[model samples]
Each structure stands twice: as C-alpha cells, then as structure tokens.
Target: MMCFRQVTLSLILLLLGQATPSRLQSLGATKLRLVGPGSRPEEGRLEVLHNGQWGTVCDDNFALQEATVACRQLGFESALTWAHSAKYGQGEGPIWLDNVRCVGTESSLDQCSSNGWGISDCSHSEDIGVVCHPQRQRGYVSERVSNALGPQGRRLEEVRLKPILASAKRRNPVTEGAVEVKYEGQWRQVCDQGWTMNNSRVVCGMLGFPSQQPINSHYYRKVWNLKMKDPKSRLNSLTKKNSFWVHRVTCLGTEPHMASCQVQVSPARGKLRPACPGGMHAVVSCVPGPRFRPQKAKPPRRKDSWAQQEPKVRLRSGAQVGEGRIEVLMHHQWGTVCDHRWDLISASVVCRQLGFGSAREALFGAQLGQGLGPIHLSEVRCRGYERTLSDCRALEGSQNGCQHENDAAVRCNVPSMGFQNQVRLAGGRRPEEGVVEVQVEVNGIRRWGAVCSDHWGLTEAMVACRQLGLGFASHAIKDTWYWQGTPGAGEVVLSGVRCSGTELALQQCQRHGPVHCSHGAGRFSAGVSCTDSAPDLVMNAQLVQETAYLEDRPLSQLYCAHEENCLSKSADLMDWPYGYRRLLRFSSQIYNLGRADFRPKTGRHSWIWHQCHMHYHSIEVFTHYDLLTVNGSKVAEGHKASFCLEDTNCPTGLQRRYACANFGEQGVTVGCWDTYRHDIDCQWVDITDVGPGDYIFQVVVNPKFEVAESDFSNNMMQCRCKYDGHRVWLHNCHTGDSYRANAELSLEQEQRLRNNLI
Candidate 1:
C-alpha cells in the first residue's frame, strides 16, 4: 500500500505538471524568525524558509494598531491599516489567532501580543503572515559568523583535529602527530602532514620562547619525523614524551597560540600525558630566532700638527726694496695676520721701516692691501726701542712669494714738527724791491693816493692803511715836495682819490681823492686832504640817528656814527642843535664836477661824512642833486631834503596814529600827531589835515619872541628852519607872506595820501 501510495502521488504530480517543488514546500526544516527593536520595513519578511510549511497567526482581537506592529516586526516601514478579508491572497495552512493589540513601542509582534499566536480581527481568508524588509542589515553579525567558520573550517581546527608533520603534503588528509596543544582549553594534536618547520616554529614561539634568539642547537631532526596516528595514539605517544610542552599548535606561521619550544597532541582522539620528562624523543615545535649581526667600530681622527709652529712677522707699508716683513701668498691666495700677536712694539718697527713718523695704530684685515694668501706668520714680538729695520725680528729682507698687490695694508703718521722751520720768513726785514703804488677811483673819481717802500710797498701799505680805515691821500707827489724822486722813479705816484681805507688794497676804496698833500723827513710823510672839487667829498653826508615810531609814537631808536669820524678833528661836527638851510630856483646855477678833478690817485678810495648831529629829533638831506658853485665859488643850491621826524618824546594817543614819509612827492606830512603842551605853548600849529602843498613847520625857540597885536610884521617870528619828511626847495618866499603854495604830488604819493585818508 505504501508503495502504491507513493506511485499514485508521483503520477498525480506528473499529471498536474508540477515538475519542481514549491518554494514554501522546499523549506522542510525549522525556519529562523528575525524580530528586533531596530527592524523596519522594505527588508522583506520576518521568517525564513527551513522545514517548509506556511502558517498564519490568529489575531483574534487584532486591530489595525496590532497589524502595524506586526508589519514593523517583519521589517516594514510604518504600517498602513490591517487588511481583514485576504486583501493579498488566501493562505493554505491553519491560521494562528489570539489576543493581540500593540502599542508602537513593542520590540516584536510576539512581545506586543497577549498570546503566542498573532491575534487580530482577521479571518482565515486573511491569515496574519509577515513580510520583513528592514532598512539595513546588521553586517557585523554576518562577518563574525563567517570569521568563526572560516572558508574551509575554523583556523584552530585545521591543526587541532590532526597533528602536522614535516613529511605530510599540504593537500593530503591530516593525521595526529606526537605534538599536542591546548586550544580552547582542550589538548589537541597538530596535523603533522600539513605543517612545515616554519609553522612549527611559529607555534613554539606562542608557547613562550624568545623567537629572535639563536635556535641552531635546539631543534631535533628525529622528533619532527614522528608519525601522527589518531588522537588516542598521539596521547599514548605523549605519555612517554620527554620534550617541551605547549598549549597550542598551528600550521600557519601567524598563529598567535604557537609555542617556540613546545609539544602538541591531537584533541580529536584522547587526552595528553600527565607528566612528560625533558630530553625525551617527542615532537617539539619551535620558531627559529631572528638572525642578526653586530657592526664594527671606527678609528679616531688625526690631530692637526701644523698649528704648533713658532711665530713670525709679515707685512709693512712704504718700505724700500725688501725691508718689510715676509709675506707668503700660498696657492695664489692671500690672507692677513689674525692680529692676535700685533702690538705697539711691532707697529713701531713697521713705521720705522716704512720711513714714516710713528705708528698710531696697526691696521689688520687687509685694510690698506689685498691680503691674498695663506696666513703663515702667527705671533709677532718686538721691542719698540729698535732703531732700524735690521735691528728687529720683523722678518726683514726675507724672500716672499707675495705679490705687490697682495701685501697687507699698513698706515703711519708723519710728524708735523719738522715742517715748522721751513715756512718761516727769510731774514725778516721786508724786501724793498716789490713796491707798488695804487691809485683808486670811486664813482669815477680818485679818492686815495700813496707811495710805499721796502716790504711796505704801495700795494701792501695801501692794504694796511685800508685795514686801518684810513684811505691814502689824494694826488700823490713824487717830486721834492713830497718825495725826493721823480714821479714813479723810486717812489710811487698817485692822483685824484677819495677813500676811507677799509680793504686789503686801495682799489677797494669807495670814493674819489687827489686834492692836497704834505711831506716829512725819515718817515717819508704823506697827508690826505679833502678835494673840494671831487664829488665824493662834496656829497659826503651820513645819518646821525635813526628812530622808528608805531602809531605816531616812538617805539625804539638807535644812533650810528662812522668809526673814523669819531677820532678826527672833525668830530665836533657831531655836536647837537646845529641848524643849516638853503633854497633856490629849479633852474639855478648847479655844477657838475669834471672827470679830470676826480682821477684815481691810488688803487681805491672812499668818502664819508666825518660827523653826525641830531637836532629837533630829525634832519632832512637830499641824495640826488648837482652841487652848485655860484659865480665860480663852491656852494650847494637848488636842492631838496627828504626826511622824517622820529623821537622817543612823541605822544602815543591812539592806535590809528602813525608817522610815515611819502618819498615820491618830495614831501611828508605828519598824520595822527598828538598835540602836547610844549607844541601848543610854542605856537606850533597842528597841520594833520593840511592839503598837499608847500608849508613850513615853525617853532618859537626864544620865549622872548612873541606875536604883537599892533604890528603885522611883529606878529610873525622868523626862525632858522629845517624841512622834514621828503622836502622840495621853494624858490620864492617873503617874511610875512603865507607859506602855503600849490605843488603837484606824484602818483605813488597820491595813493599813499588816499590810504592815510581812508
């Protein structure tokens, strides 16, 4: 009947054309189900195929919430509502239903449900089956499982199941050997046929032998040949073994459990021996020590013996021939002394050799020459008292390879005391041959003249007199009147001069001269006289006092007088209160001094007013005018004086008051003048607002002179007058006539007048 049943079943399957079994039916073993906290959808299905059969859970009280939880357990994304009436397809097996409800917190469907079966409100048509599709798989667990099993088997089992022997082929089935090991706490035999000496050595090293040490004497050839039987045989063989013991053995050299000097046995068959003695014939494993060779030592360095030689001296400056130190240029190269031994004594020797005064400093480092060679000379010793080059140990007259350009630099100082005597005067009497008579012209007129003799020649004496501020006399006479010689014979002849000698030569004098002269005995006397015809002497004048005022008030004042005028008979002309005045027509008798009357008597000349006097705090003088000689007599006429009143006594009343001069108008007017008791008491009228014209500033010098009521002529008092602030001559004026007169003002003067008015 069983056979008939099998035949019918097979035929039925064939008639149905079902050649292959269904996937669900192919799973005939128990399947593993994955349910965890981190599971999510899309990974597909919680249960995997084992012994094939499909079953459904009975979700008796199942709700959408419970279905969502089951879906999550099956590795789905957040669930939709549960499908009640077989929304997918009808399942073939019995449905498992029970009390089921799930909060979202459940780790698995079984944990969330009240019963073992998945209970929900699902009919048999809608069986509670699962589809797990987690978002990611735990790959670490898979890796660990694979590592534990390995590709062939566990790494430990490769040797633990059988003993490894040197004679066994790598591809052959392994057998137990005499060597044993404790792996995972169990004694095992090494697979002898598959293991090599290298593998044995690795195993032995893991058993605690220093693998880097020498192992040339430790390995036995006979022990490695022991044949491996079963695990029991390996144990029996180890019972009488007397070699080292190890816990583990490996065929691979990298195995960490291998011992360097240990015995192993197969654990698949039996236990190992309890007490194995040493030195017995057993299969001991070991790792050979690493090979190493020691390196040899080197010899010491040689000492430099050339540096111990005695000292020598080398170079000197300005020496003739070979009197200097010996300098050796080695290998076409130059060097200098280190200066370590250079001192004053050595320097003195070098100076004497060079024919210089003395040695101030010994310069090193090629200061004056190109130090191009090896430095052979080191220490130099010398006493400064050595007189000559040969008397010292300064390497004199020694032949050297040094070139002239490669000599070390040296410098010396020459004494200044030797040059003093050579520059002095020769007999000191002043030579008499080089006398020169200088004739000077100033403003086209001679102002100085003189004769010089001996070393006090005309040129030198003129220079000396000019230095003394005394110009040579005009018209130098070389006849018996002034000199015994003819003109320019033995004495110098000069003419037409005017000078105030203040220069190194008469040519530097500033005025015309040659007017008069005198003579004396032994001294060869000469005298200077004012040439009344010379323009320089005729126009001689100077400022006595200069004062400045601000706001019509005097600020500060000064007095200047020529030094020559302070020392002569004309010094009395500087006395105060002197008065002088003149008036003439515009076309009067003016004289132009002729050229012959102003010839140069000496090299140079100057003219100066011998004295200066200040009266009424101001004075007026004309700079541009011809000197007039009326009726062939010398006199000044038709001149104007431009001047300003400046004194410390002027009243300072207001900020706008000021004193100024209009030079273009040939006149001046005092503005913002402060009236004082003295000015009013003297009947000096305030003319601040007077129009442009000619007027006189009168002052009553004598108190007795007074205006009378009866006589018009007696009412007016005439006084000696001086014009102030740019003056012009008035041709006509009477004793009683009003002084006012019409006059034209220049453009510059007009502008100034307008500014003062504003």
Candidate 2:
C-alpha cells in the first residue's frame, strides 16, 4: 500500500515536468546528418543542409576540433576521430565548405570559419567525415532525414577533358579532348546531342576557363580511326562506350557550372545507351585564360658530377635579358658557344637555365652582337629535355670548327605576372592601329610603360593583333615617332621582343629581360596597324571554261604577246601567223571574298613604277597560267606580272570605293573583283607547240605567295582540256577542293584518254 502511494506521487511529479525545450535543442540551429555507406548512425560522411539541399564539407582543413562540433550537432557526446580523404565514402551533391577552421569549444560546426557554402577547390577525394563517441543522452534518439526536401538526383562531381592520344597532352590542353563528367560515384560521358557553344562554355567555366573554342572533331576522328586496331567495333572509345549520364543540356552561356544550366537527363533515350545515334560522343574544347596553367614542380638540380659546376650560364649584349649571346662559365672564364648544329632545342636549355620559358628564336652569326670571349663549346646537341646548357652533349674545344662570329643567341619568353591583361594599344588614328603599352607595377606603384621599337616587325605584331582579337597584322612599324602626339607616349618597359607569329599573346613571345630602356625612348615606341580580316583571292571557275578558245595571231599582232611570252616558244622560231599556233585563252576573275581589303603587304616606298601601264603597281606578279598533261607535266605557260589591282566592279549592295589613283588605300576591296579578260595580253595558256590531245589547264593566283591572305587553297583553278592542234575545248573546271565529289569521274575520264578511247 505504501509503494503504490509513492509510485502515484512520482507519476504526478513526472507529469509536471518543465514545458520549455531543453537548452541543447533551443539553439535554433538545424541538425546535421551522418550519411554514407556506413550502417551505424554515428559513422558516415558528414553532411549539412544548405539552401534546402544537402551538401558535404571538404576535408581540406578539417580536424578533430571541427569534428567535435559536428558530432555534438549530430546528438553525440564527443567526436572520437575525423575521417579524411573520404574514409567512409564519397558524398554526392555540392561540397558545401572548404578550408574549415573551428575550435573545440564551438557548440556547432556552423560556428566555424569556412570557404563559404558550395565553394571549394577540392575533389571528392578530400571529403570530410567524422566518427562520434558511441554514447548519447538517455532520452536522445537518432532520426533519418527525409529526402522530400531535395530530389535524390545525381550531382556532377568532376569534369575531365580526355585527350584522344596520351602523347598529345603537351601540344594542346583544351583543343583536343573528349569531355567526361562524374556522377553517381563514377565518371560518365555526355552525349553530343544539342551540344553547342553554349554547352561548351558552361563546361569550360566549370573547368575554370573563360570561353569555349572550336574543336576539330573530324580531324580527331580521322586520327583516332588510324590509331584504332579495330575501328569497326560498335562502341566509341573516345566517348567511353557512349555511356552517357546527361543529355540535352541547355545553357545561355552565362552559367558558372554545368549544374547551373537547365539539364535534361535521358529525356529522349535511357542512360547507358546511345543518346547520339551518330555514334559520336560529346567533345568540349575550351580557350583557357591566363590562369589555366597547371602548377609545375620546381626544376630539380642535377645529382650527377656536373652538379658541382656553379655560376655556369650568362647572356650578353641583349637589350632584354633573354636575348643575348649564350656564354658559359668554364674554370671561372666566361666563354661563348659555337653555332655549329645550334638549334632551338639547344637554345631552350640555355633559356631555361636563365629561369625563362622556351627559346623563341635561336639566332646564329652573331645576331645579338659578337661575344668578346673564346668560343668554349661547339656542336651542342640537346633534346630540349635538359634543364641547363651543361646537361647537353657538345664538343669541349674549338675542334668542331667554330668561331666567335658563330656564337649562338637566344630570345626567351618573358617571366612576368599580369602580362596578358596589362598590355594596351594607344596613339593611332584608329583604335586598331596603335603604339603598344603595358602597365608596369614597381614596388606597388602602377604606371603605363611603352615597348621599345627596335627589331619590331610583322611577326611580333601578329601576336599583339591576336591578343587584342583584331585578327592579323597589316603592318608592324619599328617606330611611332611620327605619331608623337599620341596617348601611348610613356616610359619604355620592354625591349628586344621577338615573336614566332604563332603565340596567342605578346607576353608569350621571347624578350631580352626586364624593362631597361634609356629614358624617353618610349616616345618612339613600337606600333602596329592591324586589320580585322585579310582578303582571300579566289579564281572564278565558271569563267575559265566559258572563255576557252584557240587564238592564232599573225607575227605583227603577236609582237607584244611574243615579247611577254604569252605565245609558245615555237612561235619565235615559226613563220608568219605563228604557224597557226593553238593558244588556249581564258579569263581570270580574282575576287576578294574576305572582310578587309586585299592589299599588297609592301608600302608606297616599295611600289614599282610601270612604264607600260603608266601607273605605280603594288604587285608585279599576280597570276600564272599553265597548260599541263594529265601526268602533271607542264607543256606551256603564260605569266602575267604587272597588275593594277582595283575594285572596278563589286558584288550587289556594295560600291567600288578603292582606286589605284588614291594611293592612300590599295588592294581589291571586299565584295569586289579585278578581272583579267580572256583577250588580255597574257591571259592565255600557250598550247601552240604541240598537237594537244588531252590536257589540264591550271591557273595560280598569288603564285609567289608574296602577300599574306586568309587562305591560299582557293588561289588555284584547274580544268580538263582537249586540243587537236587547231581547236581546244575546256570542261570540268573547278577551284581547289570544290571538285572532290567528281574526282572519280576525272579518274575514269583520264583512264579512257590514256587508252585513246575518249
């Protein structure tokens, strides 16, 4: 009776417990969940709720202090240990935090300092996790979080740009690669369906690049087909068996990551299937910005006997540090290397020894001025893998027939930060034509400095034009003294710049060294006149066949033609009427199909005065006409040298704006044509000497390749011709590459002609 009464009193006291929540639960912080392959609730990868979704924290800077806070938040008494490198298992979704810092006294992990939500430079291998103590409060219970808040969809983990061949890794990093995406703890490929520049931009951005570039998938496919032992195998190894994880990704090209774009996964087809029926997988090419370089290891010192040789290399007389005669310190005496077998590979070793990039130009013949010392070494042969000039194989003495005048010189790439973005152009009539300037930061002070004008040429201007996105360079000027009042007048910062015309930026060009110009020399800085586009001169294919005829002229009328070699060589030896010479005449219409004017590269100072045309002609030899056998043997040729290039006629909706009289502007303007009529003096392919059966008439424009054009392929036109001593007929005339579909027909016709059956 007494125990029953006490139990009743205890039940009454228990029912009167405090109505307020416990202080632990009263913090108003959301609880974190332990998730992964681990079965126990106390162990697994740690995850927290953010933006109504779950994300993992990067284990970059995680430790026991942060793990203690994580354990307490998950209702554990303390954290026993922290798991790094995804010890439990890799987590999906976003990596919420990185480089996290926390004190053990923190009540929750949220109170710690981190790299902010969903931002990390970590891979899945750096996932943070924690193992908590096996004890909990008596009344506490673990509850599994429901997936209703966020869908159980897979998140993109990593983006890998797989190259077609492992050997091509050093050639181009982003231009040639098969794109792969990571999902569901496995790396999978994306189908090429609807894969446009927009999709590529997003992927490139996710890979930390600025923009997308075009990839030559066809070229890669051709190369891959040649490499594959069994190409007919239905699976594409480039796409990794077409195991696509995502398809139909739509992006406006503004997304920072692929996840931010609107994605449709297996909408038209199922996963692990061929989403692209063409059997081609998705490929992404990115234009890497300035910061997209891999972190390179420091160059290691050699461990061999030659390692003790100190104070080894130096450059001399170069305006820049890297542009100099390569000299070696041997027995405390500075001596130069001979130019025998001296190449870029040998020069690159010298450049690297001076703490610079590869050699831009390996100059010989004392190009950087003669070194006063003895030529110490000769026949230096390097595979371009050596770290220093001493590592290369060479003759020890002057036995290799070397001299001081044959000293090797090198121009090395500039080693400077902010080189790409700090460059600018100023001091020209147009923004595209200007003096080059760069912002120099010295002791934390910023000021604009000019590039020295010495040795400035078109090759250096090509790099500057490409870096500015202004297309090819028209003219590279060595001095801007004429434009003295321009805004680019400043102190000189760079000198002795030499470029190969292939670099994407001027900074990639080889330089002498640092900014070491005499004061006020920047006023006459280097300048360039850049053209947005260059002309592409193509021959008119239809006109060649339409104007085909045989011209037999008398001796008096053939005087001009004979002098210019428009007629055959037999005409000079033959009687009057040139023995009824069979001349194959044709009209050549050269069209300017590019955006800018097709001007000769030479300036007014170089223009040749033509007495016959009574005009100063910029180009002396513009076109060549030839008649050849089907076996590629030339029977006769006609050369047209002088041309008054002008826009006599234009395409629809365009005007003939340029003329030779102005002299201010030259070249065939865009949308215009300079026509050399069939009746012109030298427009005939002289077939007068032979009894022509079947022939191929070819016309080549810009034959010398003197001026730079956008393309050179379209400059030639060929046609099938038949001549029987008196009359000639032309058919199947076409420009380069346009007649590929009819190649079989031409081959069959040639076979018939060879058998005398045509």
Candidate 3:
C-alpha cells in the first residue's frame, strides 16, 4: 500500500510539473522555496513558485526586513544580510514578482503585498539573495571562561545569579543566588538601579525556578554567618570601582530570559562608570518549587516531626539530567568534590540526596568536564545508607591542593520515566521484549492487569518501550489472543489508551476514562512486540581527530555533491576554478555498540534512488553533524540527504551481513562500524565566514527518532574543538557511555574497544 501510494504521488507530481528530489518537495507548490547557492540551509536566493513554474524575485526595493520574512519562511531565526546585483548568479524563467515590500514580520513573502505575480520590469540579474542568522543566538562562549577574563566571551543578554557566602550552589540550583549579567562575553554585576521582583521572576524562570518568594538577606546572613562585601567597597584598596554591566532592568515578571525583558544595558569599564549612583549591585534570592526540592523523609507515626531541609548537590556540564561533575555545598559556597577514594557508595549518597534512586556509575577524575572554583572535599567515604554526603567522612587536607581535573563525577540511576514496576512485559522471548501490562495499586494491594486492545497503537507502544528501557518502539500489537494464558498475564486493566507517543511513562497516557474491560485478559489484552536490538550509534573519535582536513574542490567534480546542495552560494555563478569551495573534511566511523543489528526503517522496494550517489537511499537521513559554538548554537551543519548503510567492520563475535552496493540488506550488524570516508560526499560543514574560535562538534544519530533501539541515550557524540583558520584541533571526543565510564579510560579498556570495532 505504501509503495502504491508513493508511485501514485509521483505520477500526480509529474502531471503537476512539480517533481523535486528534496523532502517536502511538493509542499507549498505555489509558495516560496529558497534556491541557488549557500553552505547552509539559511542562505540562498529568493525563489517563488507561481502557477506551475518556479521563478525568481526581483531585487526592487528589497531590504533586510524583507529578507527577514523570507528567512523566517525558510525556518530560520532572522536575516543577517541580503545580497543585491545577482550576487549568487541570475535566475532563469519568469520574474515572479517585483516591487515586493515586507515589514519584516510577515509570515510569508506572498502575504507581504507584492506587485502581484509575474509582474516585473527587471531581468534575472536583479535577483535578490539572503544570509540568515542561526536560530538561538546566545553569545560567543569559550573554553577558557574565567571571572578574571573580563567582558570578552559573555553573551549580550545572558543573565546569571551568583551566590555569596550563604547561598544555594549547583546541587541546590533553585534556592538562591546573586544576579549577574553577561555582556561582550564577560560576566558582570547588574546594578540595583531600579531592580524589582518582576526582574527576579524572569531571572528565576530562566534558571529553571518556578516562582519567586521574598527572601530576607539579613536573616540568611545571620543564620549562615555570611559577611557580604560592602556596597561602597572597592575591588582593591587602591581604586574604588563598581562592577556593573546591566542597569535599570524592568520586567513585568513574565519573560523567560533576561533578553526578553526591557533593560538599559551599559558597557561599564575604565572611565565609564556604573549607572547606580546609590552604590549597590542588583541581588536576588529564590525559593525552589516543590518539584525542584528533594523529598523529605517523614518520621513514622510522629505528630511533631519537623521538616528537614534537602541536601544541596548539583551536576555540572552534563548534557542531560542526572550526570556531570558532582559538587557539594560547604559553609556557604558550592565547590567540587575530590575524586580521591571516590566509590559507588559515596556516589549513591549524592544521588539519593538529589532525589534520585541510586548511582549507576561513580565517575572519577572529572568525567563530565573540568569545573571552575575550589575543590572542597576529598577521600569521601559513604556506606550507601547516608541521606546526604555531609554524613560521609572526608580526608583531613582534602581541599589543600586538588585541581578541577580531579573533580568527581557520577551518573545517577534514573528510572526510565517513573515506571518503577508500574508496567512490565509479559510472555516474550527475552526480558526486554514482551507484551505490555500495567500494574495498579488500590487499598495497599497491587493488581497486575493487561491493557485493553481497543485503540492501542504504536504511539502508545513507544511509551511502553521507553518505560521498559528496551529502546524505541518497533510494533504495536492490537490483539493478544495468540499469546493468551501466558505467565505474568492478568485481567485487562486499561482500555482505549491513547498516547501521542512522546510521553515518558505509560501512566501519563490519556485514557478513555475509567477503563472497563468487557473481556478477560486473554481475549482483549493488547500485546506489543518490543525489540531488544536497539542499536547504540557512537562516532569514532580517533577517525575525526586524525583524518580531519580542509579541501578546495572545484564545482565540476562536485556535481553530485551540488545536487545534494553541499556547495556554497557562490557555486551558482558557474565560475570554475575561481569559485572553488573550501570545505572542512573529516572521516566519520559510526559504530553499532548494541547487542543487535541496526537496520533501516524503509524496505528495499521503496528505497529512494539518488542519481548523484548512484545508490539506493535506504534511509532519508541516518545522522546529523553540526558545528556549534560553546553556548550550543549551530554555526554550520552537514546536509546529509540520504545514507546507504552497510557494515564496514565487525567485532570478534559478529559477522558481516549488510552492504550498500547492489540490492543487499542495508544495516550495521552488532559490533560493526559504517565508515564514511573523509572525502565522502556531503561529509563537511561549510565554514566560509566562520571566524577562528572554540567550537563543539556534535553528531546525533536518528535525530527524528524514527527507528527502534535498545537505548537512545548514547546516540549523540560530542567533541570540543579549537579552530585557528589554518588548523583544527579536536579534543575530549566521547559519547555518553564513555562519559558514564569516565573521561579517561585505562589502556586495557581502550584496547578492548579497538578489538570490538570492525
């Protein structure tokens, strides 16, 4: 049916004269599509589709505001600049529209009042071009971020709160801190020049805090014996200088970030003084909502029990929750914990204190990343029963000479969603593969039951799969009559479970109200076929570091690449050697680290044939490669259109089975690697105008989350890089699994990885 649908759609498109090789090709057939040249998706010549033919927009009265609307239509944040005089070469065919006017905020160009359609006095040489800014521009952050570095690496509108002596640290993030703003890549103090709780609310929301509560700074100082610096004090006794960056911030208490709030910003340095004539910097304190606060242990049968404060601990530099360098609060300020004598017991204590179950792994020697500030405790010992790390013993001189490199780390055992025995798979071949079932607790008695077969689909099955830690959802079984009378089976508990499939837990699924089963478990129970073959795709760090290089390829030889839109905007000019594109090239080896093979979702009969690559595209997009700034904004990205999957190498116990060439099965067998050579087509992010600086090389596999896997946590790989125009240095390349193990592994373990790689 799918094949027939695809063929019929192709015929319809051909009849309409709207065939395209790109995804969503027929979408908005009479609308706009950005064409011509560009290294990334955000930059291109403006083209419009009128009637049946695609045409170009004339550069008549076109401005940056119009470019902004066009870029937004192409799904970009905003426009950086627009080109005139056919900078990306002239377009052929009819001039769709001329005298186009836009107010910059229009949803689409057509909505912005143009000179009708197909009306223009100019030729193709008047075609307009545009370059867009990447979505989510924070500022240029770097690896060498320090308090003494001044205002160089800070973002213009980034705001943060720092704590003095008595305050919440990284572990207890929501409790309290002094507000600070980042300007020109440096952290600076915000002057208390008309600051209010409305501004505090906005800052707290940005920090993941829910609400604002009035805090008595004097009471806190007295309780913790905190001695704050006097407002009139000088940085040094020699000179009296006030540290301030933002002044007179005005917020209505509803903005998400400080950037959204109205504020008078200042570049206060040298002779330029701060705006606060009252000699005070803005300060703020927040009370964490119930969700951010750890659960308290209530005394049994005690009417006069007092509530105890939750332990203070936090993870730093973690991409996701429950992992990172562990920090503990001592006295008032938060500091890193020493890795000396660090074990799972001490890690478990830290995890439990932060409202997590147990420690999955105790990472030593700063596995997440190096942290700033002091190393407070060392040689910490815990028996796994302590409620907090404060109950553990520490070395006498723990903080004497510890460095950030020795900072302790941990990966907490966060349950897949909140399904802690609430749901299970019954009557399956393996533990990870099974039919779905739900457990309900009523009157202190637990009852095991099955889900009703009515309206049960793959979307609901996804939540079940994730809850079971069995990877992505593969198939949803509507009926379970074939597997009836099996072990762990029970009466039907839930009926008509409707899920959007994005939910983390099964209980979160919307139901058809109080589920009433019309039949027994064996007759109407909904079954699921979960796969244990969840593939863990990890990038080869060694290949990226050793094989990375820059190349200047001619437009002629890159014809196949151009079809995939791999070249920059200048390529459209038909200029030969002078138009050669400079590309940062690197080989990427993707390894299947799971117990089962990684297979393509589409069947061979329906595979897309790419004329450029002369191969059947088994998968639309297998992975995403991006060059991002330190603050997680993408600078350049690889347009990997399609992939021909195959096993280039395999582990000792695995065998080669899949290949890209010919009509063979396409997949990466367990313990095997799929190598895309350094010079492979579309394996580079065009860095035309990117300045030399620190960057993060991030690659995410199955970004669409289409395929099933055993685990999705290890699908992303990241590396810190420093590019200096002529050279690129890739460092700290690792996956989440390696992060759980430790940043630096033993020689024996490294050898084992090499042996397992194909």
The global Cα lDDT (0 to 1) of model 3 is: 0.61
Comparison by lDDT, 2 against 3, better one: 2
* Residue clash pairs of candidate 2: 320-512, 320-513, 321-512, 321-513, 322-512, 620-641
Error of 2 at 451 (Å): 14
TM-score of each: 0.16, 0.38, 0.39
What is residue 624's positional error in candidate 1, in angstroms? 92
**Candidate 1: stretches off by over 4 Å:** 1-64, 70-76, 80-97, 116-127, 132-163, 166-232, 235-758
The Cα local distance difference test for each model comes to: 0.28, 0.62, 0.61
**Residue range 583-613, candidate 1, lDDT tens digits:** 1112111111111121212221221122332
Q: Where is the poorest 10-residue window by lDDT in model 1?
A: 1-10
- Model 1, residue 87: C-alpha shift (Å): 11
Better candidate number, 1 or 2, judged by lDDT: 2
